[model samples]
Target: MAMTVVTGSASGIGAATFSALAASGREVVGVDLRDAEILADLSTPEGRQAAVDTVLARSSGVLDGLVLCAGLGPQVSDAKRIVAVNYFGTVSLLDGLLPALRGGEAPAAVAVSSVSSTQITWADNPIAGLDESEVEAALEVGGDYRGQLAYAASKNALTVAVRQRAGDWGAAGVRLNTVAPGAVDTPLLQAGLDDPRYGEAIRSFVGPLGRRGRPEEIASLICYLLGPAAGFVHGAQFVIDGGVDAQFRPTAF
Candidate 1:
């Protein structure tokens, strides 16, 4: 059986994907804050390292697939925390697991980005090019609006990183890609709806489909990308946002 590691597997898209993969008979290991096979926070370097170590040991240094769904939304109050978990955390875990993935059979990886990356303008975003120290300094100065900016920047950066590393990953027989979902009806979306700061915005945004997406819908796309059919589908950013991206940024993508 193929062994896969899915982060943020406790809830939302991660949970849905975990169930789907398990039902398909693959040996799936989940990493999350709680209620997972490997419980470890993705927001800190130490936590990421712990998750990596445990996963490699558990999978016996061989991994067939990886899905990085752990993240924080724009409604989160801590800007640094948002960037730390979403961007750095995802990147760190992916890098750490690459060796194991390379050792496995036709390994593949998928990461979850957000449609908000396109909606939010990040041309002048300081976090885009900054190193760790510079990012911290910028976030500190950003004050009240840093969280939102961090959210967008993190996703955007993630998308870019996946594309940038595609060549190397392909050379090693490991495919890497990203998925950007719109307003999906998940625990994370519920948290945004519960927040007074971003509730209205979250509620107001709708796609041409006229409804929020289900977690399984996103999982379907992810699973496809991880399967044999996606052999040629590499270094791609799939926007599964219910046509929202189509309606607004028709030509932007």
Candidate 2:
């Protein structure tokens, strides 16, 4: 059976993807802070390392699919935390698992970015290969008061980071890509909507489709990217945001 590892498998897109992959007959290992085959906090380096080590040992150091959906919303009250999980954690875990992916059958990985990634340009992201201390100082200097910019920066940086690694991964028979979703109606979205500071603004912004995305909808796209169907689809970013990105920057792309 094909072996896969999914992060944030506790809820939202992660949970949905986990279920979908299992239903597809993949031997899926879920990593989360709780209620998963591997429990560890992606927000912390130590937790991320533990999760990776466990997956490595369980899968016998060979992995076919990796989906990094663990993240924090902008309303988390801590800008650093957003950068920690959204960017640092994803990058760290990806690095730790790259060796296993190299040994799999037609391996592939998909990371969850955001339409918010489009809110900022690559030049403004400045977080592709930054350390925690550098991210903290940058966030402090950039005045990410509510961590909104940090959230955008982290997602944007993730997409770029994945793209940068595509060459090597593809050469090694492993594919890598990203999915950038807009406002999806998940637990994470609910948290943002409930935030006193960002709620009103989030409510005001709606996709052209006039409805938030469903977790299953995003999960479908993620699963496709991980399968043989996407064997040639490497280093790409699929935006499943209900046309939000096109509406915001139609001419940009």
Write one digit per residue (lDDT tens) for candidate 2, span 65-97.
999999999988788899999998999988999
**TM-scores for all predictions:** 0.95, 0.96
Candidate no. 2 TM-score: 0.96
> What value of lDDT does candidate 1 attain over all alpha carbons?
0.88
- Top-scoring candidate (lDDT): 2
lDDT of 1 by residue, 58-107 (tens): 99899999999999887888778889889999999989999999998878
172 in model 2: Cα distance from truth in Å?
0.9
**Model 1, stretches more than 4 Å misplaced?**
120-123, 140-143
